[model samples]
Target: MMNRILLSVSGVLLLLVGTATLLQPHAFFATEGITLGNDPGLLSEIRAPGGLLIGCAIAILLGAFRQSMTQTPLILSAIVYGSFGLSRLLSMGLDGLPSSSLIAAAVVELAIGGLCVVFLLRLKPV
Candidate 1:
């Protein structure tokens, strides 16, 4: 149903992004028009969140398959994506517009967060 679709899409997207960011931080930033110079410290910071994202992605996928376990991941999805969207909004307010890719990402994050909220509302606790 809609819940499965949301989880599947979010999980796959997060998994791919997490893996890419973890494995190739420089390349990932390059795509975003940012040069992640050869700073070990900066790379470490990026990789840290990337690992968490990978874990979240796995949880989402598991929830998608195990209907009884969907609640937690759906809640997580709402929190994480909502936070991302809000952060992006804050950044825009403070620093002005970023690249097109970043703006697009913000839009997607907001939309996904909204979808999570809607799905969670519709879902009945087991």
Candidate 2:
């Protein structure tokens, strides 16, 4: 169904991004034109959220195959994507514009989050 497809796609994206961040923080950030210096504490801080994002991705992926567990993941998807997208927008306002790639990422995040909201609304009460 559409929900499964959405979750699957979203989960995979989160998984890949999280994995890349956790395993290759410098390389990952470089894509966004961020030059991370050799600071252990900073690297640690940056890597921490990668694990959390991976956890969210796992939960979202679970909902794709589990009929009884769709609702929670839908909510998670909306929260995760919505927050990321909104935060990026806020940064754009406060810190000024970033790279075009980052702007595109924000748009994608918002679109996915919006889809999750739509799917959540369509769910029947249990």
Candidate 3:
């Protein structure tokens, strides 16, 4: 179903991105034209969220195949994506424009998050 597809896609993306961010912070941010320094503290800070993302990805992916556990993941998806997208927009306003790739990421995040919300709304109560 559409819900499964959405969760699968989002979860996979989160997993990949989180893995890359956790393992190769420099290379991953480089795609966004960011140059990370060789500071251990900074790298740790950057990597922490990556781990969280991976955790969320696992949960979201699980929800895809579990009919009785749909609602929680939908809520998580909405919050995660919506917050990321909204935060990016906020950054654009506060820090000015970033790379085109980042802008595209924001848009995609918003779209995915919005879709999660739509699917959540359509779910029938048990």
* Strongest candidate by TM-score: 2
Q: What's the distance in Å from true for residue 6, model 1?
A: 0.3
Question: Relative to the unseen true structure, what is the C-alpha lDDT of residue 82 in candidate 3, on a scale of 0 to 100?
Answer: 97
Q: lDDT score, residue 86, model 1?
A: 91
Models sorted by lDDT, best on top:
2, 3, 1
CA displacement after TM-score superposition, residue 124 of candidate 1 (Å): 1.4
Clashes of each: 0, 0, 0
Residue 80 lDDT in model 3? 94
The predicted structure with the larger TM-score, 1 or 2, is: 2
lDDT of 1 by residue, 37-107 (tens): 88899889999999998999999989888888888889888888889889999999999999988999999
Q: Which run of 10 residues does model 2 get worst, by summed lDDT?
A: 30-39
Task: Give the TM-score of each candidate.
Answer: 0.96, 0.98, 0.97
Model 3, residue pairs in steric clash: none
Off by over 4 Å in 2: none
Q: Which regions of candidate 3 are displaced past 4 Å?
A: none
Total clashes for model 2:
0
